[model samples]
Target: MTIRAAHFTPEVLLEAPRRSEATPNSKGSLALFSVSTYSFSEHKRQSELRVLDISRNESKLVTDSEDASNPKFLDDNLITVLESKDGATNVLIGDVNDFKKTNYTAGTIDGSVDDWKIKDVGKGKYLIAIAASTQPDGTLYNSEKAKKPVTTGRIYNSTFVRHWDTWVTANKNSIWVGTLSKDSKTSKFALGHFENKLKDSGLESPIPPFGGAGDFDITDTNLAFVAKDPKLNPAFNTKQNLYVIKLDNGSSPKKIDIPGFEGATSNPNFSPDGKKLAFLSMVQNGYEADKNQIFLLDVEQSDPPKGLFTTPDNKGTWDRSPSSITWSNDQKNLYVTAEENARVKLFSIPLAANSTNSSFPKAVFDEGSVASTTFLDSGLFISSSSLIDNSAYHLVPSSGAPKLLSSSSRSGSSFGLSRSQVSEIHFPGAKPGTTIQAWLIKPSFFDDSKKYPLAYLVHGGPQGAWEDSWSTRWNPAVFAEQGYVVVTPNPTGSTGFGQELTDAIGGEWGGLPYQDLVNGFDYVEKNLSYVDTDRAVALGASYGGYMMNWIQGNDLGRKFKALVTHDGVFSIPGQLGTEEIYFPNREFGGPFWENKDAWNKWDPAQKTENWATPHLIIHSEKDFRLTIAEGLAAFNVLQEKGVESQFLTFPDENHWVLKPENSLLWHTVVLDFINRKVGLKAYSEQSETAKALKESALSG
Candidate 1:
């Protein structure tokens, strides 16, 4: 007898293995990566470090410890990784071949380490650069500060009183460079002393919240980093400048000047010879979604170190914004990844002098979305994923086609997923000349003869798009497997199509983008016969959440059976509650005081009379970006309007629900909400435990 596998569910999506980007050796013959999986049965997560042999396309386990992370290649045979020791981050050095047998603790620092980089200068001498939080007194900052100076109130005179999820404090993230003297007798390394790179500058390198080692680069003689301009107010400014300092001399940091470019800088990379630097920059001062242009700097070794900054001559012709930048091993070309249409593709830009204005970036790899790339002597090492696939690795050689190195799930049997169930489509946009792209997903056991409810998902960022990518949160697959024909539409403000489309939503937030969503819904109703529009539901987060509120007030609100919004805006004037004040300013053309009509034109709070749809509102208390008040206001309105509504709050989470247990509960509640409203219960085959929870949710 043959027993079929269970359909794809929230459990399958969350428990599947998550793989990190692969780090290649100097020769590019071997790569190191990690895989982590959560076990519901054990209520824990297990991680393993693996080494991949490129020649044979095989991988072997190196370690399975959960403590190890941020692995980097020190040499062809050596590696350095971060591990937790005595409640502090410690560096461990070991051979890649036999890590357990030859590993030893290299050094431990005082504070929490977010990222670290190591360079072997020569002959028993090395430099270790650690990116950690540093206090004004030059000591590393850690969790100890949480318990000391127990002040019940926090005082602030600046606009950035809070950001993202943390309260603004005196501590800033800076790079600490220290010398590691190797003991020749025992072959062990000891850390001597440390120096704060941005001591008194009142600046931070590797900007707060999400910056890491990529924000700075180090070579044998000099260090280059990007820091937010200290003069600008962080709450309303999006400017990050570049600086270089001499490692051998006690010289002050020199700001690298890019005359016309003044927006933001990221991913500083030094050439192999350490004579030139390459990075990505944006041109606008306040816009965070500006095009990322590639820039280069040439350094002359002289007193005060003369530096020349220049952008690519073809920058004016390159329409796509590069998300990441990397120099080829030979320094003749640069590799970058950018979103085109609806896919993130890797392209090669030649640096030859003969390159003409017609020289556009040539796409080398366009299979799935390229998450990250590691430039290698052979070619490029890529980590990518798609709507059905979770993780895959490929090597695009210098001359030949790309070769598949490894895949997280090679077959649908692994998690009951199939590429056939995923598809893409295009339809007429809100305007005549524009077109909208959407990804349509069907259930694993889809029956075309049966009608399925429509799951309409709007993406955040307004500048963001729904790509041919896989995600654990708000996964279209999870919705599809539960008897829905999920449709994710990229409307007017969605990126990847071009800059024009992405910029169209500014100041017209609730105008054209909302029309595009209505057009998309209408298209599905008339075109996709398998979808039951009468049983449709809409959901989104951030800008998408804002759209849900917008839809609730507009004529589109009557078409949906239910709506789910996470961390969304309730009123346009409510922008004052956001931490990134500049975001609303750039989008609406100015602050509410300066642009009264524009701010109130699309206010959802003013259109509360039409709010009759059932809504599920989810918001985190720590999400300073949108703040908890926005969610509370929306829920209050829904309740006062006599609408079916439920508010779910996570005090420990931020804008996103990242904790494993919380994510499970989130998915369970969300699925139950939509399913009950759509006149279906998709989890009938679940165990008694899940049924009890679903019943409890219904009762509540």
Candidate 2:
């Protein structure tokens, strides 16, 4: 059979619009968002600040800066913008009238700003909480310095000499308070003494490699931030405790003592009255992915923070982790966006006395995943997106339904490429009485009369779910555009389901979760007449990559014509030795020496003897989570077995292919490998546009 190649091009796949930093004003009448436009030819990203009127459902340009972010409403008449250009970052305050008029010029705050918050400290004085990175001696760490070493020679004293994508530096993040004068004649802003030193004598806040603005909260008199105690080993310990730094006396930050939450605490949000602090805490230490429980700290009380759900009098329960929390106007309720099943929904928890409702976190909105929520007098303004849509602002009234307030240029209606039609499929679970949900995305130009191949995409985290949300990487639409049906399933271990479901795969990585995937495929093949089962391909990254490797070594190898694994785990033991050891130990039930059999049972390297599927391996040299060695070992095994296989490595990339040029190449290579393996014409022969894009990406 002479198979024809698909007509989709790399440019079409790489040109999707990006949106981030969606923030709503205090009144909730206005919302600001950053929209990024990527140019593959130029290999650069240009971002603009756009403000939306929630009441009018209209949006207007706010800034012309290509790198504007963290747009926050400082007051009714002013907003703050974090502008980054030429390696320098600064905070700019823009007039609301000027922003509405599309005038980009604004007053600048002299400093490299990472995060900032404005609080009225009384008597015409304003306190600004600024989180910026600086050298040990209180000097700004510029981009040039970050690119070059502090010293001409290389020296290391700590284990984190390098992290996920960047080398470690002595420059540490700290909270600095600045005073803003209210008098119009002398309107001045001056940086004051550092309120909290994130890194002091080898101690740091928010923890390295991940934490940021979400790790801290500010009040008129006090500031609370998350940090690991210096006494503990920074390399292995993940316990992050909340510490409060008093602004009045500038005392040393004191760690709040939480009885059972030894794991990690983050996202500190202070109530309107400033008497209570709400944060997210994990019960088990070292297990980063452990369920995050909401905790409330009464500042007046000296005792530890109380777990909202684990209180002795109230057995309040929430199955999912709460994120991006905000206090209600009256400070009687806390609103948060949390994952439930395949969608991230808004949930509210009441913080009133004598409220014993266990199911207090009532769902406020149901459609699409809410990334963030801001409460205003009018209603709740949200930045939301789904599998078929990009992020946009939506305002949900307290008494009425949600209304679209802002429109994204990259929405399904405006997307240049053929958009995919997404639908959820439910099938009997691999376990008793359990139901699994899988998303089926069909090409917009789908013709049921002609069969189409299936691109079965698996998610990472093993604990992570393939949520109904937009993704720049491993997008289902990219596959659908190639005339293939994309199937994304939430197996046994996937989150957003429940703690029971999420914890099930901890020690049984390849057990029920693998079966759930297999069952999902079986259900689709039996029910969907348009699916070309014979031409199917399986692909995944990280934990999903581990599953891809597992598939090749099991009976499932015969089901798919080809397989692709990116940064997958080839050997559990190897990963334990190379990657972060604590997580592996916790997830796999102890160290390799103690649980040799448990580690060996699911080791993909051990089952290589049964492998026969054609494989494509993709890995990055800097992928610390799953080292490049895992990919190399899998590719080596494939070659030794005389299997048709290819390997692609990215030297500058980390666990995920993030660079625009590299991401374009990744899509091209993976698509080309699948085409060639499925008996279709090669990607080079399919479209000249694809060939040119690939060549340009490779050469540049």
Candidate 3:
């Protein structure tokens, strides 16, 4: 199949097949993945399951039903998938060659399941674990008829009244454990009664909003999971603890304690033998962005399995924070993904028991951001993406270079884009001897003699760095296609660089990081002759949104012709509406009252006298993280001050515009706003932007 060359616009990006992380089968000879794409002609999204043959480098459709998802290998030739049956989730078993040809029900659950796992114990019995919502009585909670008060009013005596977009209720996201056995009479797998692992513990496993299968892991006889501490206030604490329980016995969970560590713990990984457990740990309390260190535990499979704490024998302290952990096939080494120099790279760490000579992890794969990885007998299966590429699967052998297996796009030429169009620039930072990196994307049709307007995008997580990855939201390629020189800087506080740089932004919201961005913009304007800063427009969301407001009130505001802030903070003192109070508490040294001076110093509301730029304010009604009030307040100030500004609100969206239709609208309006301010054609009006840009390209 060939994809026609076209402009990488929002509509095109939305329509592009969104692929999930590919899971390799037990033999590693085949992989399973699902793809979802929005169909403009059908006016709905379509989903399908596909099987990829590793050796042949070919793919075949397994099922095209929208209800089919989460395909996994029950064995080499058999596969297990979950499908919706009468509003409840049920597992189905089928042959890999033709799933529907021999499909049959393997097990059924009473309610909706977010994630499910199966581990073969022995004989005909298997351990089944699922993460789902449960009521106070430890019963599966059905979301369709979720228990809610009849009254319209909501009362809250405790904090966490709401998280992200949903209000806190009696129902908790918990893990359920059960047994599945095969009956010789019918030769069918039957699901036994499931018991809530967190029952009466007052804790939620796989914490809401983002947690899924990664929150917990199960072995044949034991289970491990991460849960927020019940003793602390959920609103202002980041103290998620690790717990382990026996799967065969009705036993209570045992919390693993780290004497000096008070921060959060996550990503519990058990060795192949299930005797050693590894998890990532942060040392600082309330600070969620701290460097994560790998902590090992020795598990003795006694009656109640005793867990003894163990630490890595270090030659030195590592600076990078690992996002995920995976044990080696031999359990002699560990592979992890961590950010380094604006890229998520794979690192290998040698594991030794009670040894004090283990060196730091070494980088194995250093190109592109690795989204997910699976262990293979011959090598590692990596799914990664970059600025010009949507998704690509590669097999990195232990001794050789990575071999590309498949890519979401047929080729770069098929999309009218190439890796050459993207480059990185490093400039001097605000502090002496410091440097910052940024990604620079040129238009598809580029001429070295012609200058293009600048689109400066600041990333949200103040701690988050601009990675060399593809994103449907805030895509630099989309902006570059609009005839702009897009430069995204990784200023101070950006992650993947080092812990020092990441922790530098605390209490200095508008200080060194702002200067780093200013210096980056300055470098682009003065050093890059093809970029025209005179018609530049800056945009950001979340903390990046906050930076736009900060720039609006500082000297940097005069550098850009226009600014866009999405769910940004207008006033530090007016942030009580946010559900995560711990964010400000750690960033500002304490709560508002305790650190009034520090909060006031960086408050954009205090410098409203300097507001004089054309701005676009985008906020969502359900943005409980920064709250909608913050956006409204910024717009009000801009309006009252006679600044040229427009307000765009999505009543149905949360912090992000996720719905396909809503995302398209967001991109359209954002492009229109920036284009209009920079004297470029509107997105809807110019359907030939790609062709025009292509014609302007320099000869290869």
Models sorted by TM-score, best on top: 3, 1, 2
- Give me the runs in candidate 3 sitting further than 4 Å from their true place: 145-148, 301-316, 353-357, 687-700
Per-residue CA lDDT of model 2 for 234-346, tens digit only, reads 45666888888776774777888777677777889988778888898877777777778888887777877777777552223666777668888787778988889888999
Error of 3 at 52 (Å): 1.0
What TM-score should be assigned to candidate 1?
A: 0.94
Reference-based TM-score of each model: 0.94, 0.91, 0.95
Against the reference, the lDDT scores of all candidates come to 0.83, 0.76, 0.84
Estimate, for each residue in 1-700, the C-alpha lDDT of model 1 and write its tens digit.
0122476788777888888878889898899999888876777998989888878878888777788888888779787778865547777888899998888888777777888777778897878788988877867886754447766687887778888999988888999888877798987777768788778877798898888888998888888899999999989999999888888887767887776677888888887778878788877888888877776677654322121222444234567777887778787877889999888999887776533222468999998799988888777989998888888889998898899887776634566788899888788888679999999999988998889999999999979998877788878888998889999999998888888888889988899899999999999999989889999999999999999999999899999999999999899888898888999999988878989898888888888899999999999999999988999999999998889999888889999998776777788778878898898784533534345545554534
Candidate 1 or 3, higher TM-score? 3
lDDT of 1: 0.83
Cα displacement (angstroms), candidate 1, residue 33, comes to 1.7
**How much is the lDDT of residue 19 in candidate 3?**
82
Sequence-dependent TM-score of model 3: 0.95
The C-alpha RMSD in Å for every predicted model, in order, reads: 3.1, 4.2, 4.7
lDDT tens digits, residues 1-700, model 3? 2676577677788888888889888677899999888965566988899999989888899899888888888677778888876657888878889987888887778778888777877787878789988888988887665656689887888888999999888778989988878789987777788889889888799998899888899888789999898899979999989899987778888898866667888989888778878888777778989887777777673232221222343211677889998888898788889999989999988866654236578998877899888887888899888877788889999899989888887545556678888999999999798899999999989999999999999998888988988788888988998899999999989999888889989989999999999999889978999899999999999999999999999999998889999999999887777889998888999988888999899999999999999999999998889888899999999999999988888888898989876776677667777898889998756645433332343133
What does the lDDT read for residue 137 in candidate 2?
73
